[model samples]
Target: MTILQPQVGHETLELLTNVLIGNGFSIGISSQFNYSSLVELCDLNIIDKKLFEELETSNFEFVMKTLVNADKLDKIYNRTDSTFLHAYGRIKRSLIEAIGKIHPEKYEIDLSDNYVLNKTMVRHSKRIFSTNYDMLLYWMILEDKKHVDFFGRSHNKDGTLRFTPNRESEKQVFHLHGALHLYLNDGYIEKLNTSDHLANHSSIVELIKEMIELGRMPLFISEGNGEEKKKSILNNEYLNFCYKSLEDLEGSITVFGHSLDNEVDSHIIHALNNAKKLSRVNYCIYTEGKSEPVIQLEMSRITYLFSGKEVVFYDSESIRNNMRVIEFYV
Candidate 1:
C-alpha cells in the first residue's frame, strides 16, 4: 500500500472539516503529545525526583495495583508506610489540580476565537468520546451548551443525582476514562455541578483533595496495562457506558490526538471492528516533522486495524491551522 501524504491543502482540509460537521460521525480524543503540559505539571508536582526514579525502576502496573488493591494482596506486601497509597493520592491530586487550573474561565478570552471551532465541529457529531480526565471537552460543551448534551449522569426532582443514559440528544459527549468532576456517591457515579463550588468556597482541586484525605479516591482510571485498563472500564458503570456507546456507534469515527498504543487501545480497535454500521475510519496523525518511514509505519498500523474499511488519514497540524482560521471567522 502506498503511504498517504498529509492533508495540507485547503480543499482536502475543507472536505474533512465538512465530514466532521456532518451528523452520524463520532470522535475519539486521547491524551497524546498535546497533553505534555499536563504531564509536565504532574511530573513536577506529583512525582519527586527520587520517587520518579523509584517508579521508573518498578513495574507501573504492579505499583498501581498495589496502591489501589493492597487489601487483596498478601499481608507481607502491605508495609506500614503505605508508600504506594500515598503516591497514588499525590498523583490523583496533581491530576485534579492540573485540570482545575485550566478551568473554562481561564480561557474565556481565547474561547471566542479558539472554542468556536470546537463548538461548531462537535455540534453535529453523534457522540464525542474522550480517554482523558481533563475538562477541555467539558469546557467546550459549556461553550456550546445549547447544542451539546453529555451522557452518564443527571439530577432528579428530589435533588439527587442519578446515572441514567440519555440518547435523545443529537450531540452527546462520553468520558470513557472518567472525568475530574465525577465522583462516586451512594454507590453510583454522580457529576459535581460547577455551581456547587461557590457555596463552600471550595475549588475542584479542594474537593478532590478532601476526597483523598477522607480515603475516597477520585474515579479516574490511569491503569498502566491495556488489559488492566479494559478491566477497570468494565468494572465501572460510567466507563462501561462510554465503552458500549463507542461499540454501538454507527457510521464513521474520527480519532484525534490518540497514539492508539496497541496495548492500551485494543478495546478501541475491537469496537471499530465490531461496530455494526461503521464503514470508514479516519485517523489524524500528528507527525511533528518525523521522517516518512516513521509516518508510514504509524499509518500501516491503523490500516491493519481497519483492514476492510475505507481508511482515511489527516494531518493534525493541517486540522489545527484550519481550525485557527475558522476560529477567527466564527
Candidate 2:
C-alpha cells in the first residue's frame, strides 16, 4: 500500500480541482451517509422494530437477498411462507418510508453549499451515478433545476403524462441503484413527481405507503451480492439501461462516499474496469482520523480494480469544502 497525500495549498490540488471543473467526469455516490440515515430512522421507529432487528442481526442487503430468493423459490415449497412474504413486503415498505423520512428534501436550503457543488459538477460532468436508494441527488437536481436532466416522463400536447423514449441529454443523472422516487407502473419505470402538491418528505412517505397499498413495490436493487444485483439489473429494464450507461461511460470518473466493497460493489468495479476510455480515476478519500496505511489500502484496492488506469487519491475535504453536507444529512 502506498500513501500519496496532496495538501490543500499544493499546486497539485489546485490543478486537480481545476481539471475536474473543466473536463467531463462521472460521479459515483454510494451508501455512506444514507446507510447511517437508515439506521437512525430505525432507531426513531420509522422502520418497524422487528424488521430493524432483522437488519441488525443480518445485514440489510442480506435480508433483501433472502427475501427475494425466497420469493423466487416459494413455489417449490421452500421454507418461505405467506407470512414471510408478507413480512418481507412490510420490510420493503418500511425501508422506503425510512428513506423518505430521512431524505434531503427539506434540507436543500441547509445544504445550499452542497447543492452548489453538485450543480457545478453537473455543469461540467456528463453523468452522475448514485448507488443510494435515497432521493438526495434527485432533490438536489430538482432544487437546482439547471443543466441536469432527469429524462423522465413528459407531457404531450394533449395534457396527459406519457413516457418518452430515447430522449438524449448531455447532463443526465442515473440512479444505478433504484431510487425512492422511481416506481414500477405497468412494466415500466416512471419517476414520481415531487413538485405536485408541494410534496415534502413525509408526503412522499405517504405516497409510497399508498403505492404499497395499491400493490406496487418501489423498484430498488438491495441484493447482498454483486452477482445478484447484476441479475436484478438485467431483469429490470431501467436498471439494465443504467448498467449499460455505466459500461458506456468514457473519460474520467470521480468516486466519493463509496467504500468499494468487493462483495456488494463488484458491478462498479466491473464497469470501471470495462470503461476503456477512462483516462484517470480520482478517488476522494475522507481521511479524518484514518491512518496512512488505511488510506493506502483503500487507494491500492481501487488501483487494483482499475489496473492500468491513472489513479489519484486526494483528500475529500479539499476537493469539496462542503464535506458535512455530503457526509451527513443537514
Error of 2 at 34 (Å): 5.0
lDDT of 1 at 119: 51
- Cα displacement (angstroms), candidate 2, residue 36, comes to 7.2
Flag regions of model 2 displaced more than 4 Å.
1-93, 100-124, 147-150, 154-165, 197-202, 322-330
Error of 1 at 227 (Å): 1.8
lDDT of 1 by residue, 273-294 (tens): 8887878877777677698899
The residue pairs found clashing in candidate 1 are none
Could you estimate the TM-score for every candidate? 0.69, 0.69
What TM-score does prediction 2 earn? Answer: 0.69
